[model samples]
Structures are given as structure tokens and as C-alpha cells.
Target: MPNKIDFGNGSIDFNIETILIKKNNPEVKKLAQFYIQLFQNPNIQIQEVDKLEFTQKNSIILGINERRDAPDRYKIQVTPYGIMVEASQVKGLFHALQSLTQLVKLNPENKAGSIRIPTVIIEDEPRFSYRGMHLDVARHFFSVDVIKQYIDLLALYKFNNFHWHLTDDQGWRIEIKKYPELTNVGATRSNTLIGHYTDRPVKYDNKEVSGYYTQEQIKEVVEYAKDRFINIIPEIEMPGHASAALAAYPYLGCTWGPYKVANTWGVFEDVLCTKDTTLNFMKDVLNEVVDLFPGKYIHIGGDECPKARWKTCINCQRNKRRFNLADEDQLQSYFIKEIEKHLYRKGKKLIGWDEILEGGLAPNATVMSWRGETGGVEAASQNHDVIMTPGSHCYFDHYQSKNPREALAIGGYTPISKVYAYEPIPANLDPKFSKFILGAQANLWTEYIEDEKKLFYMAFPRAIALSEVLWSRKEDKNYAGFLERLQFHLPWLKTQKINLTNAYAELDYTLSKSGDDMVLHFVKAPIKGKVLVEFKHNANNFTQEYPKGDSLILSNSLDLKAWYQLQDNSLCKPIHIIYNKHKAAGASIQFIEKPSPKYFSNENSIINGIAAPTNKYSGPEWLGMEGKNFEAIIDLSKSDTIDQIKFQLYNFPAAWIYPAKEIIVEASTDNLNYEVVGSWKLSPFTQERYIEPIVDLKKNKSYRYLKIKVINHGKIAEGSPGAGHTAWLFLGEITVD
Candidate 1:
């Protein structure tokens, strides 16, 4: 229950009156400064002591021994007499200081109070050498001060790598001395997209915005992170997502000049020209990057480079022939290999997104897998070092809460639970290549994160979970215990001024169905704090806790909200789950045509009695049909009188999820012949909105088998998220009476 004290026997119950430093090291002095800043009593001071002494009163001992076995390992031994920390490296000492900071508890007055900590001999070191976190400043530029704060947070958590994403399609965020236009033109954008990329007819703010890091500023950040034992790995995007660089220098583009920095999100066709001149430009930029970062790895972004322009460009086509490349993909492989060779000349290893694995991987490239675990598995199997940063668990831009009231996110749900549950190492990976799997990283892409506050909101809690994932051994993780510990750590984040999501009011509920009988199960979500839940059934509102060891058997519709009382004596936003009762609520429903992989996994979702979650697309729920009509057979088991059937569909034009063309429900007493009970011509979706289509049942029929058919919208028109691709028809719970 006490702040995790790793090792020792006796307890140290002394107030910090003074710190006796055994070494006159700058890092050790800085550690003392940080400790004083954190627990400022105005009475404590640091004194240089010649000999090591363990006094009981109010003194702390800090010592450095060069003969220590572990270079970055620290030891903190506690006794009733004194608290002593010993380490051979600054990294270990800093970690010991971090532990010391945690021991300084906040008192009732919100001031720091020295307390007794368990006297455990803590000898700790990082599990992985490359524990890292990534930030995409190109999407939305964060100031130098903010970047330092991010690094500070990482250092506090013992994360040692800072992946600075400095270039992307949206903007160029690093200064290149040779190319003044890079910062002057590429870093500046006319405006930004006003909503999620899935929204059709994208709107812009129409305001000029510009930001870039100067060489001096970059040096400051590098030095700042270095003090915390953090390595800054600068990322320079290439080939694809080079709209900004091309906009600055028109000749770098495959097409003509006069390209503007992309104000929108997502991958674009415009790319860096595949020529000697372009290669020179990249090498020049990377040369400047090399001078800035001391880390051994330089990230040349080899992800999401579109080949459309390359297909048309004469120079690219000529290069394809020159290298005898099979296709544009192989051309990309050529590009990456060339750059990797360039970086090798500069004594740095090339690291890239998993997309670099396409066609053929470079001889010594490190892969950062973002799409899924398969890329990491594939890369590692080939004896290449891989960093497992799969988006399902590591993307902080995704929504953390399932509550619709959450801020507009890029999309997809990645709650703290999901991040904490992720295992970076793939089970299918060969044991011979297991050593190639370095570690994992969580990325904070800033397309929707305009301010530092919102950015921290998205990164925190999830990053905290990822920290444990990357640091602790796989078998040591326990969610219930973690939740308990995190509850205590929340205040520390507040003290550090982090804008973390409370999620206390979010509700997690499930529907248990047996035949026609249905029961509602509910619990507080996210933080899972103390909750009092209430439900409204059939227009009657019952406000109180549900009975213990009992479930609510719903005769009709069920509406539930789990409310968590905050410190202000008011409930945060209640997580709302609204479900309508259907005649076939618990009936066995099977889809004749399987749903698309993009939108489904669990086949029981259609008959689980739970409706589709509203916040995002594609969870374990929501059966979606792409370019195929949804035909479902529901077995009511026995003959029952049915009057009306109702179902729901989604309409998001930007995502290419259109309203179904039509819906027809037929009932049959036997398995063969069926009589039409309800039918409707569903309206086309011209805009984005979720719709629940209820076709009034006209015929009164006694039936055992109900066949429901929902027609897909077919091909989406031009200018949608998946334009020219088959529109998806998403089906939720089908309720028949």
C-alpha cells in the first residue's frame, strides 16, 4: 500500500533537515535541487560531507561508487538512523531521486510533508534499453517549453527516449539552416481543418499559424532531455507525407511548383521527388538533424508514402528502371535503402515506420510497428530490431473514454484498460528472433490536440499504463491492483499540473441474455471509482444502487447511468447506455454473409442484446458489411405473435458508411416459406449522422424464424473517406416484437 519500495529491512522515519553529498557532481546537485523543489520545507539544505556517516536525526546520504556492477542501477537502503542512496551512474541516482520524491507525501494542507517510508533496499534498472515516447509536433506545434515539460514527464517515469516527430504532411517543425524556406514557408499553414477528417466537405479555421524549432532551441531541448538521461531521436519524414517540404521548395515535388503546406490530415499523394537532387536535400536535412541529436538512431519516416504521384512522374519511373524495381513499392524500398546508407555514413542507424518493411527491408533498419503486432513480428522474424508501437494500444490521439461527450478525437477507442492490456511481444514470433524485439513506445499524434492541456489529457493515463507495460515484467501486471495504485498516484499528476481524464463517471455495462429473458449488468468505467447507478425501465425511473448479487431482468427497454460523485459534490458526466427491447432480443441471430474485418470480431454481438457503442467505429461489436447486403436469420425458437420489428444503422458520409438502401423483414412459421412483415426504402445519407430506422410493422404474423435483410449503400461517391470504395452497412441490435 505504501509507495512501491523495491527492497531493505528497516524504516526511515526522519525529516529531511539536510542532504550530505559525497560527490561534487552536477547531476547529483541537480537531483538535490529537484528534490528541494518538490518538497520545499524552507528549512532543508544540502551540505558537502567528506566521510559517509549514518546519523538518525534529519540527514540524507547520497553517494556515488564507480566500482558498482550495474552502470545504471541504483540502491536505496533505509534505516531508522538515515536514508542512504548509492549509484555508479547519474541515471541510477536520478531514479533514486524519483523514488525519494514519491516518498514526499502531500499533507492535508496540500503542502509537501516528509513521512516514514519502508526501509527497502531498492536496486532497480530499466527492463529495456530503449524505453521511449513519441510526440508529433508537425500536426500541431508545441512550444519548446512544452516539449521540455513532456520530456520531464518522461524522465519522471524513467522513460529514456524521446521520439521527436518533426516533419509530416501537415507541417515542418524543425529549422534547416541551408533551407530557410523550410521554416519560413513549410512551417506556416494558412489554416487547419476544423473537424475530424471523417467529416465531409472539410472546414478550416482560416487563420494563419506557424511554428518551428530553431537550432538553438533544439540544442536547449536536447541538453534538457540529456540531463534527465533521455535520448532525443529526431524524426524527418520522407517520400510520402512530404507536402510541407515540397511546399517550401517546389522542385522537390514530383509534380510542378506552387504546392501549399497541407492544412488537412491523413496521407496525401504529393511526395518528395525521387531524384539525386531530392536525395541531396534529404541528406543535407539529415546532416543538420545529426548535428542536433546525439542519439544513435535517426528516424527517416518510411510510412504511408503514396505511390500515385510516383506512378506518373517520369524521373521516378526512370529511377524504377535504373534500379530494375518491380513497382512503386520496390521504389520506396530503394529510397529507404539509399537513405539508410546515407545515415550509415553519418554513423547513425536508420529507424523507420513498419511500412519500410514493404517490398524489401533495408539491411540494418529498425522498424517501429504502428499498424499492428504482425509488422513487428514480421520485422523481428527477419532478425531486424523492432519497436512495438501498434496503434491499437499505443495511439494517444484515439479517444480514451467511450462516452460520446469526450473531445473530438481522430477516432477509435483506446482506453487505459486497452493500453494496459497490450503485450508488446508477439506470441507467434520465433524464439531465435525474440532478442530483436527491443521495446515499445506510445505515440501522441497532435492532429486534434491543439493545446498542451488537451495533449496531456490524451497522453497521461494511457502513457502511465504504457510505462508499466514497458517497465514491469509481463506476468507481474494485475489490473485490479494497478487501479488501486493509480488512484493514489492521480494527485501527484495534479500536483505536476497534468490534465488527465477523470473518467470516473463513465459506465461500463453488459447485457446478459438467455432465450427471451435479458438482464443488465453495469459498473463504473475508466477510473472505476465509487459509483451509484440507477435505471429507468418502461418510463419508470428508479434511483438507487442495484440489489447485491442480482441482475435486472428487463421486460422492456433499459436505460442506465453510472454516476460518480466528484470532490465538488457534483457528478461528472454520467455514461449513458440506452437500449430498446426487441422481440428477438435473445434469439439466436446468424449473419448469412460475414461482416468486414474492419468493423467486427465477435459474432455474438448481433444477438448479445447490447446495441452498438456510439463513440467510435469498429470495436468487438457492430457487425459491418462492406459491399455486401446484410442477411440475418433469427430463430425465435417457437411460434410467437410479432407486430413490429425495429433496427438501427449509422450514416457517416466522410467514413463512407452510408444508410442502407432498403430494409425488409420476413417471418416464417417453418424454415422455408416466409411472409413479409415490414419493409421500407431507406433514405440516402447526404451528410454525417447516426440513424435508427424503424419500419412500422403492418402485418400481424405468428412465426418461429425471422429473416431480416438490410441492403448495403454500395459504392460511395467521390470525396468521402473511402471514396470509390464500397460503403459499409453497419448493423446494431435488431429488436422484433
Candidate 2:
């Protein structure tokens, strides 16, 4: 009812009673069934006609329209007697059926069954032949059923490409007949790190976790995707991100001594040797991959290959000299060029991460720009095809909120607005480069993401935003209008059992301050019965006690209230609350504190200090780390007065553990550092945590600095044999009143 469906002719009335579908492909039967189920209305009778000669007077023709010579062309029209639908492909027929289903009423007013659609013409064609969504299955393996479901969702959104990142530093996820070890030994992991990344030695339960897709299973998936007109582009990362391959066969690496499928996330030093054996192994693996995927392009991950190992390897040095490469960078370029040539010879094109633009891009290679718009701009300007997926806008692992409690606690923040507002074409790029630019993609690197529900929660709304950006012109995208559409789709999403977190619900916060009295309020929708609220004088430094007293508890289906007094110009008590509810809830707070002096300092110095971390100081104040379990103690016992605390965290690694748990900041007046001041959980992926404690600080007292204690509720295993589970947390500036 939202919009009227129209064919290119005059408004017509017709009744569809019989459906005749004939095709040699078995998938066509599935398509036919899909259409039948979609349009199963009691008012319209559907009959499957096997032959053209058996068509009834009022039958609809549903088969390939070979005369048109268009694979996806479809025509839906109204005749004097009935509705006629024709297509050149089963997918096209299915699409037409979806359109028809959209036109009919759920419950018709009359059994006579008369439906009318407006006279509208739509000769729709894709802007880019490759509209893709890449999933890092290597970091964490999803079941075959989940993959199929993901495909179905992509098909629903009209996405045509699925770039399956099947191998990486953490694990290998596909079976190769020539190298059975790729799956048998490479697919499994010894242990995954449970906490954020840090120098601290952390440990997990140390259990083995692994999965792989068999050749037969891969074929089934490929066929399933083909029926939906979606091509599966499998990425077999080469030369680098080949820790798993090195682990499976050590001789493949430049070191040729020791390595394992990385248990933790992040780029490792181990890389594929440019030696003959390594190249041959890669060629054999690619040969097997090409047989499985019919997509014109094969992605060879060329991102994040560190030069540390290459610098020291004899074989790498030999390859560098053999290829007339000047340095390691040129060596990498030469290596990629060789692979590109191989793929080209095999009747396929090669695609790589934006890094392929480093030395000199391959002639016909495409680039997936992930670091930022610069790579994409560079690639397109050089007349190379590019797909813009900068981490700022398209990375789904960052925190989506300003509150520390709502983020994934690993990566930087990438709010819904940022994702929705992303323009595939950068403003600075040459206009000519725009033509070379294909559509964009939102990548879900599942290093920390564990389940499908969480994946759906993070993808939707954002995915919807991406879809509109890809399908509609940029000028047509209105934030408010998109929100309205999102509201409507929420119901459908619910029906599909998708767990989507509405960003609007998390933005409710109110603050008020009076003479010695201050108030703060927040609203939230929790799926569980209880949620925790922690109050801290200094959010940067705090600690948590396991069972109780760490946070306050708010109970019942009622508003929470707390009262406190100021002593020595500081709030006598900082209240923390935790509660459980059946549905979503909201919170409010009031406190008393004496006003302190306000002075304007150098904002640049503050910004610079807070934004970047070095050896002398930890990175940005907003930076939050998770990976290894460690206690961060912020000493607030010496400060005169505190106003705000900002944290900067390293970007979450491309793995499933980064999105697994909530990162919290606890505060303590003493170095022993105790009590929860502020807390944040991971919300998909956007990184940045800001906490402004409403409590008053003791003036002219010994309360100086604050401490931060980071806790990881056992999520991911360790990264390597000796490597501890870790996450990076950077600290910037602590603004005080």
C-alpha cells in the first residue's frame, strides 16, 4: 500500500488464475515455487502448465523470454482476459512475481478478484555489475545454512555480488582438493584470545574452535546463489594474511620455520614466500577456486601485508632481485602483478584490497578501498576500477554510539548517520574517475562478531542505507525520509526474526545542573530483565568486583531515584545502578556539587594530546582496548576537580572477538582503583567513548588522577601459541573542572 505497482502500459485490470512455467534448470522449479508461495492468494488460482500448447485462455507465460536476448528482462502486462508475465530468466520471472505479489491485496474485498496497477515503466539496470558485500568468514566460520540465509538477504536487497573472504591470518574456511591440508589443518585454531589486546599476558580457556566448507557444499551454495542472480566471488588471500596457509604448510612462508593460523586478530609478520613452491601452491589453490566460482573477478587480499618478514627473508630478497624490484614495496607490487597476470591468463580478472595501489596497480585489476577515500581516489584517478569501502563509513565493527556502554569496545565509532551519509564518490576525485567507480559495500569483518543475530542487528538499517545509496542517486537520500522508511521496515524485520537495535532509542539523554545540584537521565531498551548503570567521579580509572557492589541496581518497572550531598565541595556519594526489565527502559539521575573554576585552555593541544598516543603517553583519550583481561587503574586522588574523560582505542582487528563484549571504564579515588564510573558495551562497530560524570569532585584534596580497569567477559580465544588475548586501549586527555 506504500506505493502503487505499474507496468509501462495504461492502467489495467486483470485476474491471474493460471501460471505456466517451463525450464530445463532445476533452480527454475525453485523460482517457480518461490513465486507461487509469494502470490498464494485464495482469490487467484495458480496452475503449473508444463507445455506452451497446454496454456489456458487466461494463463500467464512464465519462462525465459529468449527472443528479447536479455537475461534479466521481464514484462508484466494486463490483457482483456488476464495478467500476462514473461521473462528471459527464472530470476527475472521471480522478480516479476515479487512485483505482482506486491500489487495484490492480502485479503481481497471481493472474490471476483480485480486488481489494478498504474501505467508505469521501469527499465531498470544495475549501476555496477558488481554490487558486492564481503564477509570475512576466515576470522570466524558461519554455517552453510547461515551463508544461504545471508545470500537470501542479499538477493532481497538486489545485491549481485558476495565476496567471500574465505582465508586470512586467523583461519582458512574453504576446502581445496589439491591441498586437503588447507582445510584439515588450516581451518582449525588452537585457542582464541578472550580479552582485549594489550601487552599484559592474558589467557583463555584454550579450546579448539574451527569449521570449513567442503567442495560439494561450496557447489551447493554457488548454485543457490546463481538461481538468485547473485555471483559469489571467493577471496583467497595471497602472499599476506596467509598465516593459516603458513600454519598448514610452513614452507609456504618467507620464514619457512614457524607459524600458525593466527589465534588473535591483526596483521602478522608471516607472509607467503615468493619462492617457486609458494607460487605453485597458490596457483593450485587458485585453480581449484576458479573452478568453484564463475565470477569474472577473483579477490586476492593484498591488504595489511607487513614488510618485517620480507625485509629479512633470503627468498624474498631473491624474488625482489629476480623481478628487478627496487625495495620490499616494489617486491609486493611485482608479486601482485604476477598473480594478476596469472588470473588474466585464466580468463578472469583480479581484485585486491586498496593496498594494491601502493607501488603501481595492475592494468585491469579492481581495488577495494578500505583504509579511506584516498586509496579509492588514487585507484579511480589512474583509470582502475574501484569500490569505496573506507573504514570511516563502511567498516561495521566500530562503535555506533558516544556512550561507552553501547559500543563493541574495540573499534572506533561508525554511527548509523555516518554509514547512511557515506558518498561512494569522494568530492576531491576527478570527475572522470567517477565513471570508473563502482558501487560501495559495507564490510562486516567478523573478528569479534560471533552469532547471526548480532550480525543482523549490525547489518540492517545500515545495509538498508547502503542499498539506497547504491540504488538511488545521492541527492535523493534524505535522512529523515530514510528514517521513515526504516520505521516501516522495522516491522518486517521483526517478522523475519532479525535482532535490530534501533539507534534512536539509545540517543535519549537529559542533563540539568543547579547550585550544587545536577541531574542526568538516559533511556534504553534491554532484551534481558536487568541492565547495569554505574556512577563514577572519574570514568577513566575504575575497577569491577564480580558479584556485587561494583554497580547500583534499579529494579521493578519504575523510575530510579537517588539523592546525595556535597562534602568538601565534592559529591559525597557517586551512585551506580543495575537493573533488569522485560522491555526497554529509561533512567534519570540528580546530584549536588559546588561549582568549580572554568578556564579556556589551548583546544589544539588538548585535541592533539587526546587524539594521538605515543610511547610517552597512551593513544587518544577515547581509545578503548579489549582482548587481554587487564586492570587499568586511573588515580583520581590527586586531581583538584574533574569534568570529562575521553578515550581513544585502536581500531578493532578484523576478527570475530572484537565485537564480542562490552568495554567498561571504572573509576577509583585511590590507586587501588575501585567502582564503576562509566561503562559501555559494543554496538556493532564504531569506536570512541566519552563519559562526563555528573558527580562533584573534591577540591583542594589529595584526589588526583583516575584509574581505568578493563574487563573482558571471556569471549575470543588467544591469537597464537604464546600470544595472549589482547585489545588496545588508548587514553587522551582528562578534562577537569
Best by TM-score: 1
- What clash count goes with each model? 5, 107
Give the clashing pairs for model 1.
7-120, 7-121, 8-120, 8-121, 583-736
Please, what are the lDDT tens digits per residue for candidate 1 over residues 1-737?
22234656645566678887865666677877667775767677887767878654577788888755677677787767777888887678887887666655522223444667767766666556678899999989999999989998888777889999999988899999999999999999999999888675679997887899999999999999887788999999998899999899999988866788999888887888888789889999999999989889999989989898889999999999999999999999999999999999999999999999998999999999999889999999889999989888899898887667789898878888888898877888988888898899999889999999998999887777888887766767887677766766677788779987866345566666665766666655444445566776768877885446435676766677766665445565676766666667667777788788777766556765567765445655577888899997888889888777767787776567787889988878887998787898865433446667777665555789988899998987776678789988888767676
Go through the candidates in order and give each one's C-alpha lDDT.
Answer: 0.80, 0.62
The list of candidate 2 runs beyond 4 A from truth reads 1-16, 20-34, 37-127, 198-201, 407-409, 508-737
Task: Tell me the tens digit of each residue's lDDT in model 2 across 1-737.
Answer: 11223445565555556656564656656666555554554444445455643345555566565655565556666555455676676666665665455345322332234556544433333344456777888877889998888887787666778889899988899999888888888999998876555423565547787999999999999998887778888999987899888888988987675787788877787888777788888888999999889889899989888888888889889888887888888888888888888899899999999988888888999999998899889988888989888988888766565443453535666767777788888899989779888878888888777677777777776777776677555556676677655665665667678877555324233323222222334433221112233234334533332233223232332233222221112221222232222111111111111111121122222222122332212212233333343333332223334433443333334322232244454444554555555555545545423222222333343344344333443444476222344533323333333
Q: What is the lDDT of candidate 2?
A: 0.62
Write down the worst ten-residue block by lDDT for model 2.
Answer: 587-596
